[model samples]
Target: MKKYLQIVDRHKASLGTRFVNNFIDTIILLIINFILSFISAVIYNVTFIHFFYFYNNGGFLWNVFMGSVFGFVYFFFWENFTDGRTPGKYITGTKVISTDGKKPTTRQIVSRSLYRLIPFEAFTFFGTDGWHDSMTDTRVINYKNYESERQLKDEINSIGVKETA
Candidate 1:
């Protein structure tokens, strides 16, 4: 667990970039949601006055529940496949990773995703503040250098190139 919470290289990302990524991701998701809802309504034949009233009145709670569930499902499916990136993180070239330099475990991914609901990782009590930013002890980092160990390999390759030339 401690290894999982390790900090990322400071050069990889900034707080500002993290913020914009989140904002853009949210806007894109909102647009997608609107499109889905429109499709649902159309398929249900909500063009007629009676149909609109019946569907809206009958499925209000269910619709909200399904929407919430869909959000979680979307995050889980995409994040796992994309190496901890949502659309926002992907656009910003950032991702979450364990400190120990390994792909995250299934439990780790789910926990981290749930922890994201902590509202910017901020909390307060007893006249002080606390952050869940370290919940995973994992750091948000630029994806490019996620594999720092690769630097050594690149250096070796560079030396080989010079010798061959």
Candidate 2:
């Protein structure tokens, strides 16, 4: 239907926009990680006697596990608490929503975050949607479209008109 197509077009974010959002988010996360690592190094140097044994005995597996945990927590908490908008989404004027154009449930948000762990998931955006979105039945939509939809509904209601869509 015309309405359905229009809604889909309005809600879908362009691939360029998605790429930019991801780039910005990655940069921000990297900066934060760098600062934390610097602080840890300074602390370790000051308390060398206490942490020398643990610090020298490094585990690659532990590092990977902690990285995954950090990524999960960062994405999950931001999207869940911010109405599906992370810092990157906020800056890019995009937000995650259910396929039906509503806020996604907590489970959907968590699934979307976890799906990011998929190897080469970034390439999945070359298709219709990213793996995270496709798997979770969610979409990252333009906030402008969402605001316009809300205004339209409000106007219709004020005039006592029922919208079919």
Candidate 3:
């Protein structure tokens, strides 16, 4: 409703905040990929020295594919488990919510994560929203600001109502 828009409009995450969230999450993902790659190499009889360099073009591409897969899973579970907050979102003070100003459903989280696997999806942020957000009808917001605004709205709404004791 009108009150919902007021809170969301004032606290929606900016592109810059989104960028920071992605940056932090990507770094964490990279570290995870590195560790996994090393473990895989060890299981396959490759020496640690070769870990720094993939042996073939396919290996490089495999890493990229796995990275995307892991990223999807990470986004999905983190959002669902933490009420729309990933480690990056938490660090950046942001949260994801449905367009109607409610917590996103499991389907929304899954769809949002899947859309991220699209090529060049990050580039969508150049406009009003990223594909993952727009396609899933979700928005990332400044968590503290959104919560405060929502609290104020709740208080205002209760002002003219009679209490039932």
For all candidates in order, the CA lDDT equals 0.61, 0.79, 0.84
Point out the higher-scoring one by TM-score: 1 or 2: 2
Clash totals, every prediction: 2, 0, 0
In model 2, which regions exceed 4 Å deviation?
1-9, 49-63, 157-165
Clashes of 3: 0
Across 1-165, the per-residue lDDT of candidate 2 in tens digits comes to: 111324644678899999988998778777776676666677778877545434334477755665667778888998999998889999989998887767789999889889988769999999988999878878888989877986897787789666587
Question: Per-prediction TM-score, please?
Answer: 0.65, 0.80, 0.85
Cα RMSD for candidates in order: 5.6, 4.8, 4.0
- What does the lDDT read for residue 149 in candidate 1? 45
Name the better of 1 and 3 by lDDT. 3
What is the C-alpha lDDT profile of model 3 across 1-165, one tens digit per residue? 312454665678998899999999889888887787667666557454543345222466876786788999888889999999988899999999988888999999999999999999999999888999888878999989888878988999999899999
**TM-score for candidate 3, residues paired by index:** 0.85
Which candidate has the highest lDDT of all? Answer: 3
Query: Per TM-score, what order, best first?
Result: 3, 2, 1
lDDT of 1 by residue, 100-161 (tens): 65566667667665665544442221222123234444556787765564576578778846
- The local distance difference test score of model 2 is 0.79
